[model samples]
Target: FADLKRDRHDDETINTVFRSVHSIKGGAGAFGHERLQHFSHHYETLLDLIRNGTLPLSEPLIDLIVAAFDTLADHVI
Candidate 1:
């Protein structure tokens, strides 16, 4: 809900995702999961930029994030 379907409260959803990814990164690092940690670091960075308005949220960007998240899921699974 960071773009097309966004509402006034959508920021909460965005922030929640950022936090979740951040936690995953931290856990991965602690466990020595370098690949997971590295991917998550970049994913978290992208989310950070989007939430802070450093990067504009667009459909293409959303698709990119979704694909990256899928990769992250693969790393964990």
Candidate 2:
């Protein structure tokens, strides 16, 4: 995900990162991790915005997502 913040418009980077989070969210929900599911839901929403182009991919946005990912990861662990 560090690679995402480095490039503002790397489409592959965007898709890959979004998929990673979405998959994590889905897996967490399936495993009954409510805290992770809740946190990931918000992250997934942001990723959906980016994936759908509703939110333009930018350094700041990616940085924010990365920070959110850190928080989510902490909770999951």
Candidate 3:
């Protein structure tokens, strides 16, 4: 989130986040963290779309991403 906030088009940060969330999602499901797994799945989907160019990286979208990042922290800890 910090890196992406500094540069919304930061592909490295985006990829890192995607991979991190993907692992979280997998671990969540395996360990019975259903809510986190569900949330991360959707979040991961959004990141996937952004990385694949299916979703445009607009300021508003970045804003949503930032907000979601905050919510994800709550889910994680």
Better of 1 and 2 by TM-score: 1
Quantify all predictions' global Cα lDDT against the true fold: 0.81, 0.79, 0.85
Best by TM-score: 3
lDDT of 1 at 20: 84
Task: Give each prediction's root-mean-square deviation over alpha carbons.
Answer: 2.6, 1.9, 1.5
For model 1, residues 1-77, the per-residue Cα lDDT tens digits are: 44434433466667887998999999999999998899899999999998998998777877787687778778777
Listed in order, each prediction's TM-score against the native is: 0.83, 0.78, 0.86
Better of 2 and 3 by lDDT: 3
Model 1 TM: 0.83
Off by over 4 Å in 3: none
Q: For candidate 3, write residues 1-77 as lDDT tens digits.
A: 66565673578778988898899899999999999999999999999999998997877878888788788877787
Model 2 clash tally, residue pairs: 0
